[model samples]
Target: MSAARHPWWYDAVVYQVYVRSFADGLPTGEGKGDGIGDLPGITSRLPYLRDLGVDALWITPFYTSPQKDHGYDVADYRDVDPLFGTLADLDVLLETAHGLGLRVIVDLVPNHTSDQHAWFRAALAAGPGSPERARYLFRPGRGKDGAKPPNNWDSIFGGPAWTRVPDGEWYLHLFDTSQPDLDWRNPEVGDMFEEVLRFWLDRGVDGFRVDVAHGLYKEATLRDQVRPKKPKKSAESMVERVLNDEPMWDQPEVHEVYRRWRKVLDSYPGDRMAVAEAWTQTAASMAMFVRPDELHQAFNFGWLGTPWSAEAFADVITDSIAAVSAAASAPTWVLSNHDVERHPTRYGGGPVGLARGRAATLAMLALPGSAYLYQGEELGLEQVDVPPEARQDPSWFRTGQPGRDGCRVPLPWAGDAAPYGFGGPDGTQPWIPQPDDWAALTVAAQEADPASTLAFYRRALAARREVFAGADEETVASAEGDLLVVRRAGVTVVLNAGTTPVALPQGEVLISSAAVPGGLLPPDTAAWVR
Candidate 1:
């Protein structure tokens, strides 16, 4: 990590905001409605972000998109969509975030672009022989069968990875057919992506959260991916097709590209950082993206898919810390994002299970690394049930998978309102319907209740701010056993995984997840002290 890179990130707590479902500024009259949550709408919520003690905000891709994969399928890099507001709106957001002392990191999907993008469109219009087509990875059909694709690599959405272009040859799409993967092996492709980075950096944006960082490259030989033994019809199968398990990730060339980008970032002030999304299960593989010449940090997905257990979480966290130590960079933890089910849903749903979810949040923050908290997670929001007819994600539609619609529901801001204050002023219908229970746990309701999860998070975040204020990786200390304990600076965090209260060394209690008198911590509760 260069001293010139994003310093705000080292001791920061990042709040991941999924714009489409966060807060819709516009509303339609129908009971079931769809409207855009423009940049202005996000701007209006800066106060809420500040109150949450978030030093940084990581918004999912908001570039011009086709909505195929929410905003993951970017159609244009430079232009801002009319539905989501314009370039000027982004300028305002950056200014507002910086004014509030929050560093803004936008999602950058450099691995691919929506097939609807002008480059892809021109490639199709110019035919396979055109030089413009070479910008993307295109391969000819197999043998004499001109229609069949070159290889059988499956798409993350489903079906074949190769999409037959409107012309002759087929182009590679690691994800949905609408999203064609870029050819990172090509020098021009590298240059093109670098230009995109400069565009955002020039806009005064702090940094980027690289989407599918590992998928940027692939095996030079278009080999068939090893399919799962018992191929079930679930999202995991799609992942088996094309994800971090591939040999393409952490490719030598990818490191060179990152090194170049890191140098570019070093030229800026306040220090910029790039957080890579590596979807591997083990922390060992994750470290590759955060080495001295690679990404500043990579998503530690070990906890994301693991079963809910304190012991298991301890192992994952310990392994992640070891991985970061080996790479000379700290790890990053993400409980939930647009791609996975919310933590509240994953670790047993409903109010009774909230302690488990909060325990996970506390565990992540207590560790010595950059932590990512998904939007609405602080409110202990559960996943929304999406009817089949209401599903829009291509992954779900084409693959018949449940997809991530459950976790990407609209946020609940007002105490009692339609779509939970995610819609326009009257709280009308939003782009996605809020969960039935959202109104009860809405932000307004929680804001007024001291016992609500929102308040707990405020206290927890305040604690984090105090502990991490002047701390570093070396300042973090750990204690082993069923109850995982971490101490940073003067703050000691102890999480009780068992059902009974446990004794702690004599010290004043800074905060507790449960109202356990004295030093004992209730089941699934956490406590912090000096």
Candidate 2:
């Protein structure tokens, strides 16, 4: 596709802002004084984002919620949570971001809602067999005396997916019990979400990052999931194992939801779009969410799940591009998000990890599509070891696992101390504490040092805009040993994942993840050559 024919989001570099941890506005009113990041905080940081060269920002959910699953369990679809600021605050944020030439995409959680949501409350109060209860997936218990759950499916977080209500009927919650899944089969449910889409579009937001896009529809039969004969070890394998033919996920019926959502997005101007956070086993299944008439993009998680190996990266990139291209859609690349461990930490923490992270990010940017960057990624922030008591992710409580709070720690902006300018000068503590040792990782500190990760990100993003923004072609050359070479728009990117130094192609050096000594690309480094 030509650059002119493509939408703004087609090759946009989107920055993901986990609102509650980005920056705290420190409002003295209501719950705003509790030191959580808010709309005003995001608005205040627009200049920084503009200078960073990101084309757009994808802010995580900030809607009204009890925050059981943070803001994912939204209580009110249209209003901003008081802890994050108000709806008016969001309007200013939108206006300011536009004025700064940055597009804004807010998260839309359509799969479920907070148990405190009015609909869920009504469904509970209205009891079984009522119209209100029909809006959600409420089914009668299976066993004698109606004491058992309707199905044997387990929650992604752990435990049974069904929660029995006081009236003896059970409601399905694929996540935390506080977040009950809605029945998308209900026409009213579909119509209501369409209105929700219009509400944000009319407010001048660019688009939405649809949460759990693969889960809007479930098998009508509601049968128990068939378990694998052998237990899967890794989380990715387990997810693939369970969801491969699971009754509740990646159903063909779910595509209809996006088909309707596409109409709502098309009704607005400014190239409005939506990206699906769908997790499927293969690139083909993931591509289904981004069909021409459906969502504009779907996250290519195959790339994210791949390890730090040239062969793994090459295979994923090839599969992802081929699948999404077949659908006539640009692939979306993401390294880090709110849900997983940061790439640097995952690559193997410390100096080696940071080096690999930079190289990986450079390679991702050189690809032929959109890239979503998590908030603190540019600063090369490693996942912190949050004290168990300080962890807020529901996964930690539901399961004995370490949880995602480490990646969600408050960002280090300017200070040398705890909170690290994440909040106001009053030293109000961030919701999750920032590590005191992050003094060197602060934006202010890194901005002064050219060798710093933040500096590298700025230079890399600027180069990406100047070189690859309008480039329509990407080709991955066969790997020569552990060095993976990719050519895009006349620029060649060489990534050396092996321990030995590798010879570079005869092209003028543009940028290197680390300084190249003696014209040889060192191990765990990537270079852009033109």
Candidate 3:
């Protein structure tokens, strides 16, 4: 990552690829199930990513893991899982990405590790009250009452947070029982994570997309939390708790940790960046994750669930800019990810749903900050309807609710084939079944369709780079009803998120969701005009 002629991410587009479902080069039955997608698969897709006009790529966790959390439960920080590929494979992918002018940022789960990890395993075998035990938060094992967990805290996956070790005291897991939280307060813990940070940075990787970053620290008292008003569990619950808004999350000390990371980044020849997954409802809380010397960006989820009304959308943009404008940082918007239902499903049901998906993509990219385009989104892929019998998610199994399989459906690349485009060689099944209707949505099929959403994205990306490329930070002009108008560098973008078309007082209609030239927006779409 040599210093770009311009700032690395300024006006740059980002594409996020979830490793397991991206592409399957080794779609064979020799390894764990159908281990199709590997580093080579990603390297093979670099040209496609570059053609999409994305300058930066964020690959989800591929580190050595127990797969209990689907790579989130990291077992080795410095090693690549054989299931994904080897370190040599990673180097090839990195070299290929840079050759194509794309920067690579891998996911880093700093909050917890698999209980099978050497540290956790050692702590588990060390018995009670050992100094090594201090590396993790452990409390006395109880009796009779199934040994009540050390505290009343509940796992993000459900049940008590404490999991009793067979031979020792219970250990705390903010998430699943197999993913134990790391003790960041311990000097040794900090030192270990710092080494993990340097491992990739030293290897020429650009930076990281930190996972559960705010959840790195827990309450010192380890007290139980009072559930929020919407505590009722549902398929839509992306998080077990509203941890980002909690007092202990972005503690002042967290800044110090980021400062150290920033220092490490500075030691490199290029400008390395880090982004955090912090879910907060307001701009004020989201802004806390970004400061002069801390994280480069925090995922602003305020718009993730926002109504498609113009006023509501405008308020989010306005408030977000106001929150961070003074701090001289940028904002990021992500509408879809591996964890939640696809936007098409969340917005509506059918072709109308596809329209909503395209509309939202344009709206997010048209906004005044760096944007994240999820895998399959450019093709307008809808969520799969996962039946209960075939579900594999722990949350789904525990709560009897559908899990992320809907959004995490296998990717479709080839045209109209069984298992869609993700079919493995020699009749091997895909890791996750693709939507039956994915044949028409396969990347190959859409590649030839000029009116397709896929084409719309290519044009949209060009438009973003052409119009908003060097524009200064934008400000809200008016946020009324289903009309949101914003201006940056003398250009105003007015979006209509409603069913009926709304009147615009100024600016020509540059682009519309339902406009000619196969615009990406659907229904009453967003428009940009002078």
Candidate 4:
């Protein structure tokens, strides 16, 4: 929290734009882009986001890659992939977005490089003990005949983290095989990333949304990860993973990297900053990423994963506030992202899930800090069950389980049919097919209805803007039995998580997630009063 010179992020609402599925830039007959979202697509949609009242937008990776894990596996750190658009297109997007009075943050993936990257290619060409191989985690296999991997670590995508090359040496990929982990112990890797940071900052971008911020470094000793000793409870799996002390995640050396990168950000004007996607086990561990000498903010996934209960959300929020307060930083809240199922579907499906998700969002927005909104949640979009043949997420291939394709479906903008105004007028079919049932979820339809989820979000954001204009980080939660109530900076936020109706507090109501009948808030409803 080395006080970002531009403090607009103090309570900013950032919208996450899933580039490939958001809106396609290709015209009806375009060949290269097919039907994927690109820079131009985003530039075309800036007015929509601005009108939606978000302070900034964070786009997922669009850099050059093999698309093995989509754009997360980077082959070139400097250029935009042709599937997305060109550099000139991105430059235009930055200009247009800034003109609309909205900030932009692009994703930065530094944890690993695509195996097709020049460095990795050179590593393969060169023999063992070569300088090129030193850039990535290349280790000799263990056991007889060098058939076994170096350790028992598993990839986040599935399977072993180590992949054996023809040369008898094994390389580490914490994710898909195409994404090989970089050796951060090497100073050259650090120097190369510094250049990458300066490249984007010089392009007039506002900041970066760092991908895998906690994964840049691994234990130098290549130690085995600690496993759960007892029969693991599904309820405790997340906490177990966090405190498991995994050797490859949340390493101390990762902080040193951010400390240096923070200096690069501080050097630029316009309040340049970075937000870490560090999925640390707890708020205390997560807060470590945003200390005085490090990055500005880290996503609080604990708040996002909490179940539907006043006690659950309250406990997480209390811990988050207490931890961030100690570090003199603000905690960020988010309900959905490109990786997880949409909250509307996770909160329970259909109408009940959507209502609970809306109420949860209202609760999060009412808190005194920054909040990140996934692209389609405002439209009450539920996860789509993409057909098996159409599924593309690598995790689906590695593990037979339903992958993240559900949440990555193309958004519907207009029209009553498939591809639904996705690419453009007469836009081609979406890369990941949009469902037929999404007809009513289109932005066009939502705009026509005053009671749509989009409408609720607009009013909620406006009210939130007023609540945090000059608000303090300090907050008080005086009511937390069945209903969750918090008083912050002269505003009171009450959420009815219980199963029955509750009396509304005495104040001028600013906004409500759902209709209030006879001054009584319905179950799974949230309201803000001042």
**lDDT values for all models:** 0.77, 0.90, 0.76, 0.88
| Cα error of candidate 3 at position 202, Å | 1.4
Q: Which runs in model 2 stand beyond 4 Å of their true positions? A: 29-33, 232-243
- Looking at model 2, the pairs that clash are none
Best by lDDT: 2
Residue ranges of candidate 4 with Cα displaced over 4 Å: 1-6, 27-33, 234-242, 424-427
Query: What TM-score would candidate 1 get against the native?
Result: 0.91
Clashing pairs in 4: 1-291
Better of 2 and 4 by TM-score: 2
TM-score of each model, paired residue for residue: 0.91, 0.97, 0.91, 0.96
Q: 433-483 in candidate 1: lDDT tens per residue? A: 666656768889998999999999998889876765546545443445557
Full-model lDDT, candidate 1: 0.77
Which is the winner by TM-score between candidate 2 and candidate 3? 2
Ranking by TM-score: 2, 4, 3, 1
Assess the local accuracy of residue 391 in candidate 3 as a C-alpha lDDT between 0 and 100: 71
Instruction: Return the lDDT, model 1, position 525.
Output: 77
Task: Quote the positional error of residue 25 for candidate 2 in Å.
Answer: 1.2
Better of 3 and 4 by TM-score: 4
Selected candidate, larger lDDT, 1 vs 4: 4
Which residue pairs in candidate 3 have backbone atoms (N, alpha carbon, C) closer than 3 angstroms, thus clashing?
A: 24-36, 513-521
Candidate 2, 169-274: lDDT as tens digits:
9999999999999999999999999889988899999999999999988999899887778777885785566365588899999999999989888887889999
